[model samples]
Target: MRPDPHFLRGGQGGFGLVAAMFVIIVVAGAVAAMARMSETQNATSRMAIQQARAYQAARAGIEWGIHRALAGESCSDTFTLEGFAVAVQCDTGAAVSLPEEGRSPRFVSLRASAQYASPGSPDHVYRQLSAVVEKDD
Candidate 1:
């Protein structure tokens, strides 16, 4: 309702509005950046947990192979655990005779691998392990 003294004279006006707009833009940008950073951190944490789980899965596979070999069975399997794909392969070596000790010893070798996702994926996790055990007759 007041007379437009600055508008008629074409004087500078709306400085407060301009300042408010700048502040809003800056605040919006800051909020977006924080959100992006938080999302990245969350993703990293999930990947780390997946990595550890994959390792455990692979280790379990190795142990399973050793157990089967000790029980006089061939070991080879593919399975899934906790969203991870696990594979184990085993090889049994020829028996070695020990005449001096009156005993024959056989060795079993195992290899295991665990994968959380397809290869080359951003969140993929993988783990591999190898073990050798003595199979006493």
Candidate 2:
């Protein structure tokens, strides 16, 4: 009995199938990894945007507090804008004596904080700002 030479020349019958399956798996894994990386990058970009918005809201609150303090009005309030919430507070310090001035001058400290959260996100972004203003009188 003799084996057929043609069968040997044709190569192993199952080798091609195994090689094809391996290539498919490798390609699928690479694709999945790329998708995960893209998702992570998108999330990072979104967080950066959220942080910027929170900072802007905090700055606005600070400006509001300053305006109210200068106008002799209430300087504390909480407000919401564009999905962000801002809270502002002001503290008036005791007057300080000045050598050149007849009357003492007072100082006001303003603090502002802003917070924001995106839908379906568990984390929240926050920003705070503070400033000290002196009365001209």
TM-score of every prediction relative to native: 0.85, 0.87
- How far residue 56's Cα lies from its native spot in candidate 2, in Å, is 0.4
The ten-residue window of minimal lDDT in model 2 covers 115-124
Pairs clashing within candidate 1: none
Instruction: Give the CA lDDT, 0 to 100, for residue 18 in model 2.
Output: 97
- Residue-by-residue lDDT tens digits, candidate 2, 1-137: 89998887786778989999999999999999999999999989988988999999999999999999988889999999788888999999998988786878789999999998654665589899999999755
After TM-score superposition, the amount by which residue 88's alpha carbon in candidate 2 deviates from its true location, in angstroms, is 0.3
Please report, in order, the local distance difference test score of every candidate based on alpha carbons.
Answer: 0.92, 0.89
Model 2 segments more than 4 A misplaced: 1-11, 118-123
Q: What global local distance difference test value does model 1 have?
A: 0.92
Native-to-model Cα distance after best TM-score fit, residue 35 in candidate 2, in Å: 0.4
Question: Per-residue error at 48 for model 2, in Å?
Answer: 0.5
Q: List, in order, the clash count of every candidate structure.
A: 0, 0
Q: Runs in model 1 with CA error above 4 Å?
A: 1-4, 7-12
